[model samples]
Target: MKIIAAKKILKANDQLAEENRAGFNAAGVYCVNVVGSPGAGKTTLLEALFTALKDRLRPAVIEGDIAGSIDAARIEKLGVPVVQINTQGACHLDANMIAAAAADFDLAAIDLLVIENIGNLVCTAGFDLGEHLRIVVLSTAEGDDKAAKYPAIFQGSQALFITKADLLPHLNFNAERITADFKRLAPQSEILQVAAIQGDGIPPAADWLAGKCAATLR
Candidate 1:
């Protein structure tokens, strides 16, 4: 019965998600759902991406948090269209929430829509919010066992952004193990290392995303 209930919820969510996707497709905007554990440098990575592509691509952000507007405020400072979704302890944002929020934006003017999902690995993986791709952020400070322990999130993501690579030398984490484990779980996913603070590897990451955005446009 528990599994049945879960399936019912996901089914309903997927229906709404498809509607949201249709809306995006109509407006010619590509959405990327960013998910990761708290303190994984999701915001920093966004700042890097924004800096890298702001001149070439018109980007917007949707910040999701349990109860605060901190992330949204940060993105707004970057001078882009941003909306904050306070889940009020929901832990995750579903398709319906995104669909409702979609009404507030002029989607046609934006090339890419990035939704920084509430810092969670499990719950966010279960809900589709009409994104063209899902990017999972993992910090070396979080340790190497995250991919193995949170297989669902790792496996569901399209690409993995290993943030905080600058901390690699100080930590005991093994990037090789994390890579192998992610490959074991998500064989087709791409893994990119990024150090948002120093802007290391941000260019390559930006190029990859730019390519994706170009492809979505074509």
Candidate 2:
């Protein structure tokens, strides 16, 4: 019965996700779901991307967290439209939360909608949030075994961002091995090495995403 209940829950979530997708398409907005473990520099990446992506795209954000409005405040300070969803105790954001927070945005005016999911690599990946593509962030400080240890998130993503890349020289993380793992796991996913704080790889990452949003998101 537990398995049955799980299936039922996922079914309901997927139905809601489809509704959210329809809403996004109706507004001509392309959405991307960003997922990663805590302290992976996911928020930092968004901070950098907001500056870089602004040149070509009008972007909005929906920041999800277990609690606190800190990250959401960061995005709003950039003068961009942002909504914060505090999930309380929930491990991940569901389609219902997205559909509700998304209403707060003028989706018609935004071409790119980025949903920064709860900073969790496990429970987060199983839920569909009506995104056109998915990005998974991993930090060098977290070590290199994460892709192998937590395969689900990496396997389902379209881009695997190695954040805090500037720390590579100081850390013991295996860059080549992780790259090889991501390739073997999700060959279709683009791999990016980023140091959001220093602005390394920000433009290329932004350009790649902007290109995808422009060419295929319509």
- In model 1, the clashing pairs are none
Q: Can you give the TM-score per candidate against the true fold?
A: 0.95, 0.94
User: Each prediction's Cα lDDT score?
Assistant: 0.91, 0.90
Candidate 2 residue lDDT tens string, 152-187: 889999988999989988999998989988888899
Quote the positional error of residue 1 for candidate 2 in Å: 17
Model 1, residue 99: displacement in angstroms?
A: 0.5
Which tens-of-lDDT digit does each residue in 1-218 have in candidate 1?
A: 34444356478889998998888888889899999999999999999899998788899988999987988888999898998999999989999999878788998789899999999988998999999999999999999999989999999998999999998889999999999999998898899999998999999899999899889867
Candidate 2 lands at a TM-score of: 0.94
- Highest TM-score, which number? 1
Q: How many residue pairs clash in each candidate?
A: 0, 0
